[model samples]
Target: MGRRLLLGMLFLLSVKIMAQEKDSRLCLGLNYGFGSEFNNTDYTFINHFYKLQLYYKLSETKHFQYEILIQPEINFAKHQLLNFYFVKPETPDYQQKREDYTQLKEVREYVLNLGFLVRKPIGKSCSVYVLGSIGPMINDTETERMSKGFAFADVLALGFSFKMKKIHFDIRPEIRHVSNAGLSGKNGGYNTRNIEFGVSYSL
Candidate 1:
């Protein structure tokens, strides 16, 4: 993974250097974020993600542009712990078995997303953008010996970007919503919301 990241960065840097003199050229970048899951009682869990984005100018005078963003992520969550903490002994039979005496388990997930954005440049080096995307992802639950796949989940984001000469940098704060369609009804719609921050540099 580290090697892959290093190689990707080097490639993006090369592209930026080559396009420094072009009036209207495409830019590529990388983004990364460190944060925690929301509504998650398990404070011990952490979430991190990485993204790659490409931008192309449509009309230089109008600040019109198009963008593509690719994000791959891993999530470690403990939502089951929250349920266990709230269960009472007086609960019904099924409830007791499912909550009170149930053990807390941790789940891990892997996801890949592809997105598109509409951007309007604000100045010589800045722009504001809105994005929407849908893609397939794989979900793996280690504790339950379960693995599932999903397709066509949606995400929406709003952020900004900065460009200087031949070098382009972007910083976008975004919200991501995902729905996992259960595999054979064994695992169903488990939704997650995340706030992501990313940075990218392109020549």
Candidate 2:
């Protein structure tokens, strides 16, 4: 009787493993979003972004599972503002323009990024995640650029992942904050936010 019981247990375990394997999924995807930056001194700028990625899942179904994401992105920036100081006595009409001492200008930037993500499932078809990355931006202006160096930033991303049989997709509304982050016309160290959409195919 003991031998029979052991055999039954092994059979059950085998069935469970097969079920999991049949339901497992792996995916590759593309992402697109809009982005912007805000300087430490309150100057503001805007940009749009795009990316391509590879996504992977290690389990079939779980309240929590491990995730891996590799993505490359491109960001385009514009509408930059530059500020300075003008003392009341230094201007032709110092007192008249004293209240408007700062100036605003338009500029543009291009940023390239590479990122890694780890995610946890919060719902049947959704997950929340966080990411960290370092990259560079080639800009069209000076003071607003990456100090002629590489740009660095950290981003927080939250979104839902969806699966249909063996196929899956992900979408995240993300907020990114950078220190010493710039392209060509805008300076580094600012807050940026964007909404991203990604679609994937599992192997």
Candidate 3:
């Protein structure tokens, strides 16, 4: 009787594993972000981006699922400094620095981010998720807050997704920070809040 009970337990475990099988998918979307007071800085920023994503099942349980994401993004941003911190009166170029840092400027960025997502199902076709990612970025314009070259972008988001047939619609609210990780002397970064809408298909 003990042997029979052990065999039954093994069979149930296998069935549970099989029930959680998942497939890969692709997603595309746009994101618009703006600076918020959470950064402890006076500068304000705005950005819009085109996003491409590919994701697959990494793990699962009866109550949760995990996914790995490869996402590439291209964005344009507008920035303006609202404080005198970047311009010190003691500096030789104080006048020039003040003139440069206070003006509105447009910048472009290229990014490739690797993300990990944790999801919980609400029903048959809807779920809530949390996602985090960090990746390399290339900035095309120099600013008082950051340098003009290589940087890192980090993101954390909370999202909801609804699936209809093979199509999935998502809404995500996120916080993002970009810095060069001290690769250069000017490492002050920009922090922003972003809302993203996206659609994905399962293949």
TM-scores for all candidates? 0.61, 0.60, 0.82
Model 1 CA deviation exceeding 4 Å by range:
1-25, 34-46, 55-63, 75-78, 84-105, 142-147, 151-153, 186-193
* C-alpha lDDT score of every prediction, in listed order: 0.56, 0.59, 0.82
lDDT of 2: 0.59
lDDT of 2 by residue, 1-203 (tens): 99999999999999988767644535667777886664445456676767777665554345456555556666665544344341326546755443442344343444555565666766656666665555555444433333434555556777777777656677787787654532332344557887888777665
Which ranking of candidates, highest lDDT first?
3, 2, 1
Compare the candidates by TM-score and give the number of the best one.
3
lDDT of 3 by residue, 34-56 (tens): 44425545787888886787777
Q: Please give the lDDT score at residue 161 for candidate 1.
A: 66
Stretches of candidate 3 off by over 4 Å are 1-41, 90-92
Better of 2 and 3 by TM-score: 3
Q: Which of candidates 1 and 3 is the stronger one according to TM-score?
A: 3
Local accuracy of candidate 1 as per-residue lDDT tens digits, 21-106: 44355666666654444555532334555656565544443556775656565555553434453344564564644542245555
Q: How accurate is candidate 3 locally (lDDT)?
A: 0.82
Which 10 consecutive positions of candidate 2 have the poorest summed lDDT? 79-88
